[model samples]
Target: MNPVKNMRREDMGLQWLAIGLFCCFVILAGGLWYVQIVSFKKYEKYREVQSYRTVRIPAPRGLIYDRDAQLLADNEPNLNIVVYLDQLREDFTRTYHDLKGDKDLPYLEGLELEKDARYLTVSNMVYEASVIIGKPSALVRSEFESHYYRHRYMAMPVLTGLSREQMARFMEQGSRLKGFDLEVRSKRRYPNGSLAAHLLGYMRPRQRTSNEEAATLQMSFDYELPDFMGKYGLEGQYEDELSGEPGAKSILVNNMIYRQEEEEWLPLLPGKHLYLTLDTDIQKAAEDALRYLNPNQQRRGAIVVMDCNNGDVLALASAPTFDPNIFTGFLPASVFKPMIDPKGSLPLFNRATYGRYHPGSIFKIMIGLAGLESRIIDPEVEFFGQGYFPMRGRRIDDTAGAGYFNFERAFYKSSNAYFIHYGLKLGPETIVDYGNQIFLGKETGLLPAQETGGYFPSKQTVRKGWHPGDTANLSIGQGKIDVTPLQMAVMTSAVANGGTVFWPRIVAGWESMMPNGASVFEPEPEGRIRGRLRASPQSIEILQKAMLADVENRNGSGSICRIPGYLIGGKTGTAETSFKNSNGRRIKHTWF
Candidate 1:
C-alpha cells in the first residue's frame, strides 16, 4: 500500500513539472510577439526621434615660428558666413508646402521639388544677408543641391574669408536673418607674405578626419568643419604632429529631422607649435642678395645656409617663389596657373631640396675627403694639371687649366685633373665608400617628403659597371650624379665641422600651444650624426684652408663670395645642365 502511494506522488510531481514548462514557453512566446510585432513601431519612432548626427571639427594647425619666436606661419581670424541647416528646417518645410500646394506628384518627383524648395529658401536667405553687407553672392543650383542631399544635418558654408567691412555690416543689420551666422575660423596667414614660402610651405582646404579617429569615435561623420591640409615643406612633413586631434559634436534631432539640441562630444585639442632653426635676419638677407640685388631680379635659383656645428638649416631661400598666403584663399588662374605650368618656372617647386642637377666641382669636396682619408693625399705635394682630366680617350674640360697645383692650390682653383688624378689613385671603391658614408646617395632627413638623396654610386653599381671614366667624373662631381643645394650645404658643413656628417634638421622642436599664453617645448636632438667621414683634423684643416683661399684669393674660383666682414670658406661648382631660361637666355647653375 505504501509503494502505490509513492507512485501516485511521483506521477503528480511529473505532471506539475510538465505544466510549469508549458506555462514558461507560453510566456516567452507572448513576450517575443509583443516586442517584435506589437511594440516595434513605437520603439522605432523613439530611436528615430533620438537620432545623433556627428560632425567633426578639426583643431587649428600648429603655429610655425623661427628659433627666435618670429612667427613664420600662423593663423589669423577668418570670418566665414555659414548657415545652420537644422535651424532652417522650418523655412524649408514652409517653402516646400507652399511649392507643393494642391499638386499631386510621384514620390521621386516630389523629393526633387522639395530639394528645389530648400535651395530657394537658402538662396533667398543668402541674398538678403548679402544685401545688408552690400556685396553680391552667387548660390549655384548644383552646389546647393549637393550640400542639401549629402549633408543636410551640417552647417552650409555660404561665403568664406570675408572682409571686415562686410563682417561689420552683417553684424549690424543682417544678424536678424534666420539661420545665417558668422563663424570665426582660424585662417593661415604669413605676415611677411612670400618670406620663407618654400620652407614654411602652404595649406589647402580639405575637410576630413583620419580613419583611426573615426573608428575611435565609433561613429560616421555626417559633416566635417572646413580644415586645411599642409601641401609641402614643414607644414606637410609634420602634418600628423601639427594637426591636433579633431573634436566632435552631436546634433540631437527629433523624428521629423529637426535639430532639438547640440552638445560638444569631445573637447578640441589645439595643435602644437613647430619651432624651426631658421634665423629671419639671415633668411631675409639671403633672399635679398639672391633676388633684389641680382641684375635679373626674377632669377630661378636656390640658396642654402647651414650651421656647421649642428646641421641646423639657418636659411633656405628659393627664388621665383610665390607667397604662401595665396594658397589659403581664392587662387586666381593668374597666380596659381603660372606656378604649376610645365613649361614655366614652377615657383612651388622647392629647388633647394628637390631639384636634381649635376653637383659639378662641389663634389670635389668628397674626392678630396676620399684622398686624404685613404692616406694618398698630401696637402703640400704638387701635381700638374693639363687643363682637363683625360679618361677613355675623352677630355673633360676644367675651368682651372694648365697649372701646377697642390691640394691647397687645386682645391681653391678646383683643378679637375689634379683631383681626378688623386681620386683615381684612391680607386672607385674607396671614393664610393666615402660618398656613401656621408649619405650622398640618400636624403639628409631634412624635410618630411621633400628631399631626394641625390644620385651617388651604390656599392652594387660601383662594383659592376666599374669604369675609370666614371671614377674620373665622380672626382669632378659631373657624371652619373646629381645633387640639391641642401645636400651641398651638408657637404660643406661636414668639411667645416671636421667630417662629422650630420642629418640636417629644419624643425628644431615641437610643443603644444597652451591656452594660458604658456608653452611646453620638447626640443629635438641637435647634431644627430648620420654617418662619419673618418677624416683627421689635419685633413679638415687643409680643406678649410683651401676653401678659405677659394674665397679670399683673387684668382680663386669662388673669389666673388669674398666680402670684407665675413671670412667665407667655400668651394665653387659649375653644373652643365644645358637648361635654358624661358626667355632663351643662358642662366648658369654656378654652385658655390
Candidate 2:
C-alpha cells in the first residue's frame, strides 16, 4: 500500500541533489571569471616582485676627433672572463650533496654547508679560469658569499683586462670552461699617449651619478655597471653631451636568486661624437718645439697658436703633460710620483690656460698703440736714448745701443728706454685704455673655470697707489701686468687681424653616429670675436711695420726668430717673478 508514496519521495530527493550540483557549478564559474579577468594585473605585479631584478646599464661614451677627423680620444674593447652564477646553480647543488656526504647536519651547519658549497663551486670555476688565463684566482670566499646572497643574478669577474696571450689562451678552450664566458666592454684610450693630454683631458671610473639629490630622492638602484666621467679640459666641459643617457634592464630570476633570462627594459641612446678645432700636426709641432727648446726637459711653460682670421685655436701645448690613460682607473703610485716633480713641474696642471706671468715686453704692443692713439708718437721722429730711461730716481735698462732711434728703429730694437719715455707721457689712464681694448685683464673663455683672468692694474688702483716708480715699471711692460700665453696669442691675433679681438675657439662641433657608419654633424659657428680695438687702421699698420722691423733687424732682440724672405714678426722678454719656487730659487718667466 506505501510503494507509490516511497517512489515519489525518492524522485523529490533526486531533484534536490541535481539543483544543488547546478548551484555549485554556477558559483565556481563566477569565481573563475573574477580571478582570470579582473585581478590579473595585481597578481602579475606580485609575480614580478618575487622574480625580477632591475639593473642600471651605462651607455657608450662619445668619440673625440681632431680637426682632421683623426681620433684623439677613443674607446677600445676590453675583453674579460667571468662566471655566470645562474649557469652554476646545478653545480652548486651537486657540490652541496658531495660536501654533505654520509651525514645529516644541524640547520645552521647545513646553511653554512650550502654557503661553502656555493663558494667552492664558484671558486673551482675561478681556478679553472685562472688556469686558462695563466693568472691567480681572483675569487675570495667572503666576497663570493656576500655576492651570492645579494647579487647572485649577476656574473662574477674571474680574469679582467686580459692580455692578448691570455685572451688567446681562453679562446682556445673557452667552450670547455663551463659557466665562464667572455664579455667585451669599452674603455677610454689615447693612442698617442701623452700627446695633447692636457687639452683632451682624462676620465675617472664612476659607478653612479653626482646628482646627490636625485640619487637620494628619486634614483634607486640595487646594482650598476661602471662608467667614466671626464675630469678636465674639453672632456669635462661637455660631460652631459658625451656620456649620453643611461638605460635599464630586467633580470628574470628564480627563488634561488639565479637569473633564468634577461630582457632590456629601456633602450640606451649612444653618445654624440665631438670634433675639436685643434690641428694635430700643429699641436705635435708645438709640443716638439717646446721639448726641443728645453733640452733639460724640465721647463714649465706653454705655447698657443691661433687662426688670426677666425680665432680658431690651431694648437695649444703645455709642458710636463701626463699620460691621461692612467686616470681611467686606479693610478699607480710609481706613475703618479714622477708626475709630482719637486721642481714644481706638475703634469696635471694646464699651463696654457691657467699659468699667469708678467707679460714683459709683449705688453709693449699695447703701449705703442696707446701712444699712437694719443698722437704723441710719430713713426718717423727720432729720439735720443742713453741706454736707459730715468724715472722715480731709478733707471730702466735697455738692451739696445745708445743712439738716436726713430720709431721704427726703436721698436725693431725693442728700445725700452724710448718706449718708457713715450709710455710715461701717455700716462696710466691712456695706457689702461689700450689694455682694456685688448681685454688684457679678463679670462679668454677658452676653458671655463680653468682659465685665468690675468692681472692688469686698473686706473683706480694706480690712482690710489700713485707711485711714480709704479708708473715707470708699467711703462716698459714690467711691474703690474700679468698674462697667459693664450692671452698673448689673442693680443697678437688682434694685431695680425687688424685689431679685431676674438674669443679663442677650441671645440668645433658635435655629431651623432649612425649604425651604418655615417655621421650626422651639428656644426658650431667659429671665429666668435670678443671685441674690436679702438685703434685706427693706420696705427695698426704702423705697429705691424715696427713688429716686422723687430724681427728683420739684426740689432733687434726678436731677430733670432727672423727667417729670410718670410718677414716673420715677434718680441722677446725675460720677466722677473715676485715669488720663489719650491726649491727656494727666484724664478724668471721668459717668453717669445
Task: Give the whole-model CA lDDT for all candidates, comma-separated.
Answer: 0.84, 0.84
User: Best candidate per TM-score, number?
Assistant: 2
Q: 448-546, model 2: which lDDT tens digit per residue?
A: 857898898888987786776776677777888888899999999999989899899988999997778898999888878789999899999999988
User: Model 1: what TM-score?
Assistant: 0.85
Cα displacement (angstroms), candidate 2, residue 538, comes to 1.5
Question: Compared with the true structure, what per-residue lDDT tens digits does model 1 show for residues 167-219?
Answer: 99888997688888898988888999988899888898875655876687676
Worst 10 residues of 2 by lDDT: 213-222
User: Each candidate's TM vs. the true structure?
Assistant: 0.85, 0.88
After superposition on all CA atoms, what RMSD does each candidate show versus the true structure? 8.0, 4.5
Model 2 clash pairs are none
Cα-based lDDT at residue 565, candidate 2: 75
Off by over 4 Å in 1: 1-50, 85-117, 293-298, 330-338, 513-518, 578-588
Question: Which parts of model 2 are misplaced by more than 4 Å?
Answer: 1-51, 141-146, 210-220, 337-343, 514-518, 580-585
